[model samples]
Target: MDRQTEFVLRAVEDRNVKFIRLWFTDVLGFLKSVAIAPAELEGAFSEGIGFDGSAIEGYARVYEADMIAHPDPTTFQLLPWRTKAGTARMFCDITMPDGSPAMADPRHVLKRALKKAADKGFTFYTHPEIEFFLLRADAPWNAPEPLDSGGYFDHTTLDEGTDFRRDAITMLEQMGISVEFSHHEGAPGQHEIDLRYADALSMADNIMTFKVVLKEVAVGQGIRASFLPKPFTEHPGSGMHTHVSLFEGDQNAFYDATDEVRLSKIGKHFIAGLLAHSHEITAVTNQWVNSYKRLAWGGEAPSYVCWGRNNRSALVRVPLFKPDKASSARVEYRAIDSACNPYLAYALLLNAGLDGIDKEMPLPPEAEDDVWSLTDRERSSMGIDTLPRNLENAIAVMEESELVAETLGEHVFDYFLRNKRAEFDEYRRQVTPQELETLLPRL
Candidate 1:
């Protein structure tokens, strides 16, 4: 057995872990788990646990439902919230009975993308500033009541949000997830947590764990935590503004101290690639129908396809350079919502950026003024294009992109498109309250 696998087994025994939850994600990024007794750890590591893939959201058909989930020992961590005999968890990689990686596995898709980056002598890293809202537990799904009225960075002596964040952070840290910052966002009851940067794979795992920890803590407090893109019509929406960087042998590939913007040729090309393919990838980054609502009503969430230095209005923002911390040089893609499947989202992002580097795409002119403020004519004249205005438009654009198709593989690409189209169809037929309110009295 590998050292990591042996170490995991030893840890489970030493900790007296009663159940070990093997975790994986569906194509749409929902967490799925299956618990096994500690005695099965060794067998799981070697042969994997069998499950019915057809039961999952975007897995195999019923006839070919057999699948295996091989636990990644490197991701082993005990659940801080669980007590008594204790419970631990490990992220699993889905595979077929023959041990071949599942093409539809979102985690495998990311690994494939990362392998491409590795082949190019680069490593991808991401740091996400995830935002969400805390609502009253008893609040109705349609009418969510905010747990607190505190606005951005407002910290009262005895704030419920603050206590919740504290507890959440504690649980995360216990699981070895390092948090960089936590603060109240601009919207009432909304909170933001910035996780320390890590490799794309590990960071994706952390994000998944982060969401579960938040929800667990919230439920324990008689509250509900939501990662919905636009939970409330009048309030600012939650977003996962992720900072991404590429590295080579301990050096930041994006750093060019001598350049005017301190961005190297590689960095510029990456940004250019993201801008070029922003529309095609929007369906994955902002997948939900409501995600468009958040993007269109822009304050922090950007709707246009452009990049700028310290410009939050643009889709991609290059944070100001700190000469002392060249490693910190990176670009933030702001359109990604907290609810996105991190694995697929990061895969598409890495592939897009890598495509730019491969092609040496030219960086477009920076949006000096706020993109949201610019008139349609002015934006068009400046060559600044807006992202797909809605999920339908976004899916249409994605459906035609070879880059998205190739990166996501045939299994995922076809399933995601079909699934999203069905979702949009269902959503369209629904009679929303706003539509009734406006049209009922008129027509």
Candidate 2:
């Protein structure tokens, strides 16, 4: 066994870990798990545990039923909440019965995209400022009520939810994840926790852990932690505002000493590529029916496809760096919501940026003003594009993009489009209460 695997096994034994949960994700980025006894750890490291892939969503057909999950030893960690049973967890990679890489695996999709970035001497790092809501449980799939009346960093009345956030951050640190900042967001009971920057793969794994930890802490405190993008109509929606940068060895490829906005040539190209493919990759970044509700015009969220410095209304914003902190310089993409699959989202994002670098695409002029307030003609004159309004429009653009098809292999791309299209169609057929309220009385 590799040294990492051996070390993980030793740690498990030392911790008295009885069960080791093998964790993975489907195409939509939903976490899947299977538990094995601690004794089977060595065998699983050498030969993966077998499972039927055909039953899993976006995995395989019945003809290709046999699959295996090979755990990554470096990701081994004890479940902090399950200390009574002494359970450990490790993320796994899916493989075919023949020991070949599975094309449908989301982790493999991300690795393939990362390999493309690596080929050009680049490494992608991401920091996600994840926003979520603490709510009472839903009665019957209906919207849940917020647990706090506070808004935008409010600290009034020192509620139990405040204590929940504080304790949750402590637990997160105990599990080896760092939280850079946490505060109340613009909406009621909506909170954001910003994570430290890490490589794309590690950040993806951390996101899963963060979600699980948040929910566990919420449940312990008798509340529900929700990552739903648009849970309420009048309230601001939750988002996963992601900051990303590219590195070459130790140097930040996105930064330069002498440049406007302190962005390098490569950085400009990356921004351009992101804007170019923004419409195409919308389906992956905002991968749900409710996602577009958060992207609506007039909200603080981005609706126009333009890059800027310190402008939240733009799809991509370059955060200004202090005089001494060049390495901290990076662009934040505001289009992604909390509901997306992090692996697929990062893959398409990196791929789009790299495509710009390969083609030497010129960056568009920055929009310093609020582009959301402008009329259609004004926006057009500014050379700014808009994102797809909904899932249907987003899928239409995705279906036509060569970049999307190439980035997400044929299998995933096809599966995602078919699934999303069906979703949009179902949504269209459904007559909502809003429609009923208006049409029923009038008719």
Considering every candidate listed, which one attains the maximal TM-score? 1
lDDT of 1 at 383: 95
Q: On residues 1-443, what C-alpha lDDT tens digit does candidate 2 reach at each position?
A: 67998899889888899999999998888999999998898999999999999878788889988999999998888888997899988999999988898888998999999998998899999999999988976433485788887889887666877887898898888777889999998888799999999999989998998999999999898789999898888898988989999999989998887886788999999999999999999999999999998888356778899998878888998888562377897879999987899999999999999999999999988898889888999999999988999999999999999998988889899989989999999999998989898999999
Misplaced by over 4 Å in model 1 are 321-324
Off by over 4 Å in 2: 138-140, 321-323
User: In angstroms, how far off is 88's CA in candidate 1?
Assistant: 0.1
Local lDDT at 98 for model 1:
93
Every model's TM-score: 0.99, 0.98
Query: What's the residue-level lDDT of 434 in candidate 1?
Result: 91
Give one clash count per candidate, in the order shown: 0, 0
Q: What would the per-residue lDDT of candidate 1 be over residues 1-443, giving only the tens digit for each residue?
A: 98999899899888889999999999999999999998888999889999999999999999989999999999999999998769999999999999999998999999999999999999999999999999998879888999988889987776789899999999999999999999999888999999999999999999999999999999899999999999888888999999999999899999998888889999999999999999999999999999998997887889998998878999999998574478988999999997899999999999999999999999999988988888999999999988999999999999999999999999999999999999999999999999899999999
